[model samples]
Target: MDPTPPVPHDLSPPRDVPLRLRPPRHRVDPRARRWWLLRALASAGAVTVVIGVVWWLWEPARPWLTAPLVLAALWTAARAVVEPRVRYAVHRWEATDLAVYGLTGWLVREWRVAPLSRVQTVDAVRGPLEQALGLATLRVTTASSSGAISIRGLDADLAAELAERLTAVTEQTPGDAT
Candidate 1:
């Protein structure tokens, strides 16, 4: 026998059990597309502008030096334009009797949960950009260092309703934390 005792978890398979760890699936409103597009454009435009200015000031490098930066900025912008849609497709949320779960992130997937009893607060915020786009962000705070769960690009009304529902549930349900 090996010197060290085999840990229980070490004996388990590497593959994740989707039903247990996987969050419930739900897509965001289509308006998220427009918001993402505007965000991408603004970000890309700023980068491009900065590159153009730098190229102008650093005359020796001329067009060659800034060419790569311009191309990269455009590519990043393009990706940004499509990011929201991809994120929306993968976004999932479920409020069970035990807890509220929110799954977000595009390239780096993150699954977060906040037990109803442990929920310290729930809020819906809409900034100027979100207002213009008819969107709002839902934030749920728990007593964890992992921090709050922020779901952005939700329809304004839906966010508001979810916030209210979360508040009600948090009040009625008991937290399962030790």
Candidate 2:
């Protein structure tokens, strides 16, 4: 007889499980669209200013650069208009007793789930822009290398509360969170 003890059914990994990820139920705050728009505009404006300066200083290259500058401006304008709305619609997150789920991205979507038992840390982050907009991102770090999940564009207060709740739940859950 083999010396190894039989693995418990509760702990055994599922075999040939089909992958089906449903979208998370909670949508990010609506203000996130405005924040994204402002950010996109600021970035595009900065690039345009730099290009304009170069075109003004370098007379000979102006003819060659004009096309690129125009193209860039058009692209930026289109993206600034469309991307924010798309991202706002697509980004959703939900936290439960068992797991945290997130769905993010516009063109390329990603869905993430982090079980409470494996969660190692919970943090709420606010950048200058996020602070200005009164928004925050809740980050859940798990034991796996690719297990970090960021639920962005949450109301600042809500994000903080969520982080605290997740921390408390993970602490009580039975696991090394390693």
Candidate 3:
């Protein structure tokens, strides 16, 4: 008198199933490129200045410092020119009822997904540079340390609205958010 239905013999997934996560649908605010550029240039300038000062002050170390100074200059040029564009092209984010998705990084990109059921908190952050550029970052925290996601370079208003929406959704969803 068994009532259970028989299991299907074919358990393999369909051949068309995607093997990797697709990129998030929305690109970050275009101004993010300028923000990143300014930040990179400022950092490079500071490091170059500091190294130049040390090289000047320490006469005995001048010969050894030459290599470092040259390397710093090269790095500065590359970062100021290349990193911002690459980062802008690579970074993207999207928020859906089921989950939040983010793609980040320039050198070693990472794709992240955080289900709404697991969301613990949503916060919008704007640093000095971001404020000046009218950009914000949305942080979605989850119970797992590695599950948290940050969607950077969003429009400030959009970020705030998204945060509020996410908060409301997470509240209504039936879960402990852990």
Greater TM-score among 1 and 2 belongs to 2
What would the C-alpha RMSD of candidate 2 be, to one decimal place?
A: 11.6
TM-score each candidate. Answer: 0.76, 0.84, 0.84
Better of 1 and 3 by lDDT: 3
Q: Report how far off residue 70 is in candidate 2 (Å).
A: 1.9
Q: lDDT of candidate 2 vs native?
A: 0.79
Among the numbered candidates, top lDDT falls to 3
Tens-digit lDDT track for model 2 on 60-114?
A: 9999999888877886786689888899879988777677889998889989887
lDDT of 1 by residue, 18-126 (tens): 3245565455666776777677667776777777787879998776867777786777766676676777677776655556668887789898876667788889999
Runs off by more than 4 Å, candidate 3? 1-20
Off by over 4 Å in 2: 1-20
Lowest summed lDDT across 10 adjacent residues in model 1 is found at 4-13
